[model samples]
Target chain A: MKNYLENINKAFESRARLGIMSVLMVEEKVDFNTLKDTLQLTDGNLASHLRALEEAEYLRVEKQFVGRKPQTTYYASPAGREAFKSHLDALEQLILNNRQKD
Target chain B: MKNYLENINKAFESRARLGIMSVLMVEEKVDFNTLKDTLQLTDGNLASHLRALEEAEYLRVEKQFVGRKPQTTYYASPAGREAFKSHLDALEQLILNNRQKD
Candidate 1:
């Protein structure tokens, strides 16, 4: 069994990063603008976090044009998905362990 | 209904803080030593995070003498408990919503 403390992904430590993962988990693919609006993050803020996730290989990015306007899209990689699930599992495990002490 | 994105507590943003709340939620009260050991955090690191949580009113601290030595204990305040639960609920909602897209 994975220890709860050790299983948490530090990459998801920020609320912004965590929120991004949450949206990606369901949507599978999200545009930079949409993600920024949904998470209410600034352009630079969202970009930095996205870059971090990308560097960690937790997210995949694509740049495409819509009607000649450039659009950036993001998707959670397979490793990203597993890391997120494990993080959620760790959270649940911690909660359950605490509940047992009640 | 609380908007899933806005409901997440930024106060629980850190892995250490989240772990602290997790331990406090079930145990009702945990000494600083136990928390430090359980989370494997450095003394300064734990103190900084604990101070942050306490400042946010998510944790209560009590300093007293255990035998001849001074011991500090921590507990999640009512607001803290509710906040953590809300954060957890938001995470679950995000996950469930993602599952539906599958």
Candidate 2:
């Protein structure tokens, strides 16, 4: 129970943050537009959330010109990946514990 | 990636609801007051959330007398347990997929 609560709680510390982290957890890197579309978020909204993730050092943002247009791409940093892994492990332990109770 | 997004999204369909589910994912049965304390929720707030979970058939509530006072305890239903397990699996697959990318 302790393990379950700790993991789910950690994984859900921030709702939007978790969504972004979950997406980055799988994709090597995704463009800002792609993230915005996948999440159905407004430009400003996505940018703000991305900024928060960047500040947390959970993600890295790369900005450059893509065919003369400014493009930004995001990727999960090592720390971010580790945090996501720990969070998932906690959730798994919780499920296993529950099954044992049955 | 598809698996990770699906699991995290389902696990977090509702913030407060997820919290309740996560707690019940372990412990066999928990009393209302105990749940309240663990979640730091008000009586009314807890009751409302409990009612929602009850309606979802995700939990079973038993009302009985403990000594002289009425005691209400909650446990996850079989279906609820299955749902939680599926959710955890999704999260795990997501983590594994991410690790494979490294």
In terms of lDDT, which candidate is strongest? Answer: 1
Q: Which docking category, incorrect, acceptable, medium or high, applies to candidate 2?
A: acceptable
Considering only N, C-alpha and C atoms within 3 Å, which residue pairs clash in candidate 2?
none
Top candidate, metric DockQ: 1
lDDT of 2 by residue, A10-34 (tens): 4334545666887887788999988
Q: Lowest lDDT 10-mer window, candidate 2 chain B?
A: B6-15
Candidate 2 chain B superposition, TM-score = 0.74
Off by over 4 Å in 2: A7-19, A22-28, A36-51, B7-28, B36-52
Candidate 2 local Cα displacement, residue B63, angstroms = 3.7
Clashing pairs in 1: A26-B98
CA lDDT of B18 in candidate 1? Answer: 77
* lDDT tens digits by residue: candidate 1, B15-100: 88878888888787999989999888999999999999999999999999979999999999999988888887776675566556
Predictions' DockQ, in order: 0.44, 0.30
